[model samples]
Target: MSSLAVRRISECFVKPQFSNQICNLTPWDIVMLSTNYIQKGLLFKKPATLIDEHHFIQNLLEKLKHSLSLTLFHFYPLSGRLVTHKTQNPPSYTVSIDCNNSDGARFIHATLDMTIADILSPFDVPPIVQSFFDHHKAVNHDGHTVPLLSIQVTELVDGVFIGCSMNHSVGDGTSYWNFFNTWSQIFQAQSQSENHEYDVPISRQPIHNRWFPHNCSPPISLPFKHHDEFIWRSETPLLRERFFHFSAESIAKLKAKANSESNTTKISAFQSLSALVWRSITRARSPPSDQKTTCRLAANNRSRMKPPVAEEYFGNCVHAVSAETTTGELLENGIGWAAWKLHVAVTDLNDRVVLEFLEGWLDSPFIIQMGRYFDPYSLLIGSSPRFNMYGCEFGMGKAVASRSGYANKFDGKVSSYPGREGGGSIDLEVCLSPQTMSALESDQEFMNAVTEFDPLLF
Candidate 1:
């Protein structure tokens, strides 16, 4: 069994150079109040030829904490707390970020008596990985009392893991990756320079202004008075999580097959991959032919907006767009049919559809209830293959593996990540019931498409 030891726990604040600022929560941010925090981590091999392991790890922790403080200066909203306002007469709630409070982000350092192989060798994700992140089951609304962002650095026998837990209300996957990449860039720059300064200019500057349609105002209020009214803190059932890697060649073959079978050129690689997994999981469950199934895709609205919101806008700018069909139709029609359905659903989510959803949301504001939002028969696919997961190099080297926390995870939850090799490859982190996972592993057709990983590669 693996053992973990904690070395330190401290709050790292932004530099005193910037003044206090306030950021109002948009409808995008408000909708995520009840969801779980976004947890992600990267694994790297220890530096070669270390004189003393303890000394090296201590030095690394100091550098990481310093760089994080600098990074928070630009992402000030993350370092702040969520402030809520309530009204008795109307029974409403309003939430915003008070950047002036400056409580700072949480930083943790620890050591684990395990090797990197213990993490990457098993077919199922090791339960020990969950210990790498704090706020295991806490929701975004908890940010009111807890730190808005918490980071943990765990040193393994031969490698290190850096994990982050950020409130979902503050941003989506886009914002999360942006903050991570920027921090890595700053850290890398400081290591290369002699003075160890964090003055390196970031490639992208995040925009804090909340976005809304014309005629719509800020401080959108919810009908509920307290977060407990909608928060879900139920215990999740036992499940199995596994990483499936699809190579560049495998992906191209799937795409070509999907497009050819569907006789349409617009079927995208993402749609194709989604179709494959959707069908595989559905088959594994062995549901009745008449059973209704759904595929919910997380779409970014920055480009879908009419005038196009800035790509660098740093808040939640994503929506869940779904495609539905009967189990019989989804499986009987083949991968092309499923892919086409996903393609149509994604392509149809244009500016007009987005505007109508926003206008309707203004009329009736409600936080997405955790246990009630997703259907048991449905699959929710989050994250994207386009994110630069392997590019977060902090002088040690490129990340050897990418993993997420236990936040917002359900039986049918799936998160897509870019492959470590950096081609057109893709990796999916799939969570499902033990029975369903067992059935999926035995599905010959599905297994044929998966690219097996060798533990030694880590």
Candidate 2:
């Protein structure tokens, strides 16, 4: 067990069913070209019994590889590569996906002799555990030279870890989960053999049309230059990462309290829970009473658009909504006040607002100074409660846990995922400064709402 290590077994390309086309990125996609890639990973507990370890691994490898190839047939954009084209007019560079099939999605097979219990327990994810994703980071390294998407299947002693890294420039959380759920369906179909259905209808396939900015007083900029570096790279203070588990019961209590103050509008579970986390983290930081504090949350605009986008519109359909107040006001106003603020901000994101946002982005892509990781007063929330994260069954069984590999590096960043046990529960991966984390650990109110996670209990 002490000598556990990751050994690469194979590398292959999973090409799409069709190729030889260029998919131009939408304005939404262009804005995120400089942003970090999305990493959604899951860990499964080892099966109770294995007749033969070597045979079990080989079977899984073949099943996953075959299904992934089929999955690419439907989601061909993922198997392509992102490239930039410099046009003579206006001197702008257009970033688009080249679906040549020559550089298909990279599939990596690896094995590590580590048990699920060893890595999952103790709540706070150790830095070493993050190394599991070090091999396939989906960041924009050069101007535009990297695989659009990559996957790694790591076989563990007790279970397996399936991780995918997708460029944010080409996909959002909706597309991310769409690919995941569809892949799972394909994988399970292969596992069940002739009894399962394999056809994913054309209507259900993703619509890849770019969302262009409509008429505005001033024409928005087409392509703007952005630095290709993360915001937290040069932070002076040391950052710490921790996962806080919130049970369905605790969330209900919080939601009840959040809704108790507002008679007309009932706060949602997500808003209520986010309010609680925002308040607790703000209190833990214990900043000056006059210090300005803000919570920047990612909002999905797929449904908010006029006539709504197709159920399977691929690309970045998410925008950030920021709720701001003084630290003192947030702490003094109670959870309901904070929840109301969050609810209102999210509700205000209607169709018109989304278009306005696109125009705003075009006017000045760099207008949003989003280096919140280094600012002690800022807290960024990623992911949503509606995503069916734990339901991603990949044949062997339901996943014991799921997480984002990129969340660990950003301080004051919170990534929310559906709890494995379900029923409106949420798991928050919170990264904070060392001192702030220590303060949160000692805060009784915050600790009281967090329930320790144990797969055995389920």
Location of the lowest summed lDDT over 10 successive residues in candidate 2: 227-236
In order of appearance, the predictions have TM-scores of 0.96, 0.91
Candidate 1 lDDT trough over 10 residues, lowest sum: 7-16
Which digits, one per residue and each the tens of the lDDT, describe model 2 over residues 382-417? 887678777678766889877666522456889888
lDDT tens per residue, model 1, 342-444: 9999999999998888888889877886678777789999999899878898767888899988888888999999988868889999999999999999988
RMSD of each: 1.8, 3.2
Clashing residue pairs, backbone N/CA/C < 3 A, model 1: none
Stretches of candidate 1 exceeding 4 Å from the true structure: 2-16, 88-92, 195-198
**Candidate 2 clashes between residue pairs 3 or more apart in a chain or in different chains:** 46-158
Count: clashes, candidate 2: 1
